[model samples]
Target: MTILIPSYEPDQRLIGLIHKLKEVSGDPILIVDDGSGDDYRGIFDTAKNAGCTVLTHRTNQGKGRALKTGFDYVREHGIKDDIVCADSDGQHLPGDILKITEAIRRHRNHIVLGSRQFTGKVPLRSRIGNSATRMVYAMATGKPVQDTQTGLRGYSSEMLDWLCQVQGDRFEYEMNMLLEAPKAGYDLYEVPIETVYLDDNKSSHFRPLADSAKVYFPFLKFCASSGFAAVLDFALLFLLQWMFGSLFLSVIGARLCSSIFNYTVNRKIVFAGRAQTTARTSIPKYFSLAVAIVLLNYGLLHLFHVNVGIPLFGSKLITEISLFLLSFWVQLKLIFKSA
Candidate 1:
């Protein structure tokens, strides 16, 4: 296995990590400088002298781009070696790196993750950040990953092309990999590793707000489209109810119109790339799901509004929340599935 480390404006810890890596593992190390500039030149030069192949970017690309750069080099050289990526901030231990590498050897078709258990003196930001992303990842993909933010991951030589094609240029790229893994017929296996945050993780360059927005953008985009359609659904439902004075007609009519609008946007835009399901195949599946959701939506609304004494609008909200997960799962796993 080849070790890939993407470093940007790194510190002495990087050299220290390299020394430690040399001690534990004899794998060749590839370092992408990621435009760390002349000031950090000495550190990278030292690393090169210590026997690492270094690639430099003209300017700072994101972490994802740096990793892709390394992968591209590997592919260009026709190296059949599998790769294991680790953080340069010293968060990843060499033993854990080897552990993930070993897991990748055992499961070459799987994305092996060196997941930290997050035990013992965790920084507040690291703790809360990992937890939030973990929950969002689970809700978005229905996959419970122990560490969605971990940089310690292994990929086989065969997975190189696919990894380079995954979306996002920064931290979000990693999340997109996990989100797309299931659809791409890849399994995720986690290897529990030691959690070591140096100096309370102040070395991290992650911009919490900006990077977090990009990381969650996929799920947020889905919600935005659905939320917009929901606004239209709400308006139509109320207007139709006021005119026809019938709950059933209002719900059904409004749902039909909104569903049509949603399907057009989702197939053409939202869930487009993850799957290649043609309109002929997806339309039937989507409508079947839509119809099922509508009936269940109507049933739940009736139960909440008429039987449970909730207001119409309140019931509508409850029904949508209840069905959102089911809709997402079916659409992702079946309707928009990868072939």
Candidate 2:
């Protein structure tokens, strides 16, 4: 397994962390000094002498950008193995890192999370913030997640590429992984890891109010637009029923209206693209494929509600879970080529 560490002006804390890592395994370690000032040069040199590959940023970027830098370096180097990524802040234990690596070896297709037990006298903000974000991630992706903000995470080479592609430039970068994993056909797994908060947990860079907004706003925006689409769908269905006098036709019209609005909004806003032209061209194809999804929605709804006697409202809920995956797959593959 490969080890990646993203650091910012790392001090003796980082030096000690590297020593611990080297003792555990002989994997190639990449230390990304996120534009740490001249003060860290000696530390970097010391780490290099201690057998760790150091990658430097010209200036201090956010933690997410630093992680992207590390991932990009690994991809460019053509390393054909999975890697375990840990923060340089000395919170993660080397033994837990090994456990994460072992689990990754078993489940290469999964995005392994190092779930931290926040049982001790952790900071109030840190505890509440982690709990909130973890629940949001699980809800948004329709997958269960224990800890969304843990830095001791492991990913395969393919997952590395996926992480690099995620567009957040700050703390939201971790949240992006949870949002896009389902779209990219990867699942989440958790390995329980010990939590060690130093300095009474005052050593974190997380901005309580600002970063929390960044992390949760994406999901909130998604929900707000979905609410509007739901209203639009109902309006269209009502109008169509009044004009055409056919219930089935009205429901179909409503489905088309809502699906189109939903897909268009998600493509443009939720999964913003790098290639301008490709994104524009993918909209039509997205709808074309969505037609098949419409059929699926109807079939599942009918099977659960009519055939199996499930309540109509609850059936729609169950069917939407399937729709979420179906639409996500098509969007990643058919719409934006690089999800």
Candidate 3:
């Protein structure tokens, strides 16, 4: 396995992380120095002394650039079957590194996230930032991930080349990949891991609001389109129901009409030509997944409204939440899979 660590002016914390990883796994460790100044040469030297492969940038590119450099190195060297990405800030534990590797071995072709539970000594900024991004991920992909901001991720060898092709100069790269993964035939799984927030979680370079916007702005754009489609759907549904006296038919028709528009806009504008597959291959599979979601969604709506006496709107709202996990899995399989 190849362990890739992206570092920028890493201090003793990075050396400690490298040592721990070296002790735990014999996998080749590569440190991609993200344009840290000349002063950080000593740290890079320390990593080299510890048997890590060091790649340095002349100037500081962002984390995304460093990560891309690592991917390029691994691919160019033909190291297959053991790949993991960890931050140099010492937040993600070495034990979790082993677990992430194992998860990759099992999943084989999926993206594995070392998910952190939101508990204990959590920084307020991190809390708010992660919570907001997690919600954005949920809204865009219908998946609920507690740690959208986690830099501790594992990828199989097959994904290395795919990852190198992603185009983001900063933090948004990972966020974009998360959105594109399901659309590109990759599976995503979360491996539960312990999270340590040191120094009240202040040892990292994450700009709370700016980076949060960078990561989530894409999803917000999708949300805008979805919102407009929703308005159109509801208006059309109300008009049809008032004219025809069939609430069930009107509601279903409205949702379908809106969902189609939402999917098209999402595939086109939001995904922005990033997804490599055409609608010719994706549309039928997408429609199949949508059909299943409609059934599950309507069933939940019916159960909530008819059995529990919830209003139609309230029932639909609740059903959307309930179907989140199911929808996310199907979307990951059907939408992200290669044709």
Candidate 4:
């Protein structure tokens, strides 16, 4: 198996990691100098002298781009081995790296993740950031991935082309991999690894606010679109009911208008379904779902407001909130699945 390390403005710890990796496996190790500049040339030279294939970028590109560069090189050189990608900041232990490689060897069809259990003595930022990201990832994809931000991962050689095509340039690229894995017909396997943090992870290049926004952008966009559509649906339903004095007609009219808007925004913006999905297939499925939801929603509204003597506004609020999560899952898993 080949080991790929993406580095930018790294310190001597990188050289140390390279040496440790050499001891374990003599397979070719590729390191991408992500625009470390002239000052860091000596370090790259030392790594090269120690037997590593180094690729250089004129300026700093993100980690994702650097990884793609390494992948492209591996493909061009005709290396058919599975690749183990690890961070250069000394956070990933040599043993854990070997474990990930071994896992990939055994589970050749699966993506192996070197997962860390953030149990003891973790930094505040690391803890909070990982916790928030983990929650969002689970909610968005319905997958319980313990460590969404782990950098040590193993991929089969067959996945090189797909990895190169995954979206994002920086940290968000990693998140996209997990989010898109199911849709791409890949299963994930997590191997437990030791957690190591040095100087509160100061070597990390991740920008918390900016990168976090990118990582969670897909889920956030869905919420925004759904919220707006729900508001419109409620207003239209209330107005139509007040004018026509017929609940069924009001519900149908409001849903017809609101579902059209929701479907368009969700297909084009939220899930990016237009590129991979055709309206011919998704529209019929979406409207079928809309019809089911309309019936269920009206039934619940009638039961809560008319039978249970609750306020109509309260009934609507409760019913919508109850179905919100279900709607998101169905849309993501079934209707707007990646092509």
Q: Which predicted model would earn the best TM-score?
A: 1
Per-residue lDDT of model 1, residues 122-150, tens digit only: 99989999999998788767779899999
lDDT of each: 0.90, 0.81, 0.81, 0.89
Output the lDDT of residue 259, model 1.
Answer: 88
User: Which pairs of residues have clashing backbones in candidate 1?
Assistant: none
Per-prediction TM-score = 0.87, 0.68, 0.70, 0.84
List the candidate numbers ranked by lDDT, top first. 1, 4, 3, 2
Candidate 3 residue pairs in backbone clash: 1-82, 35-59, 35-60, 182-336, 183-336, 184-336, 185-336, 185-337
The lDDT of model 2 is 0.81
Query: Which candidate do you rate higher for lDDT, 2 or 4?
Result: 4
For every model shown, the clashing-pair count is 0, 0, 8, 0
Q: Give the Å error, residue 129, model 2.
A: 0.6
Model 4 lDDT per residue over 1-339, tens place: 899999999999999999998898887889999999999999999999999999999999888899899999998889898999999999999999999988998887678999899978999989998898898787777889889899999999999888888888888999988887777888999999999999889999999898888988987888899889889999999999999999999998997898899999999999884237789989988888877887889999999999999999999999987677667778887898766
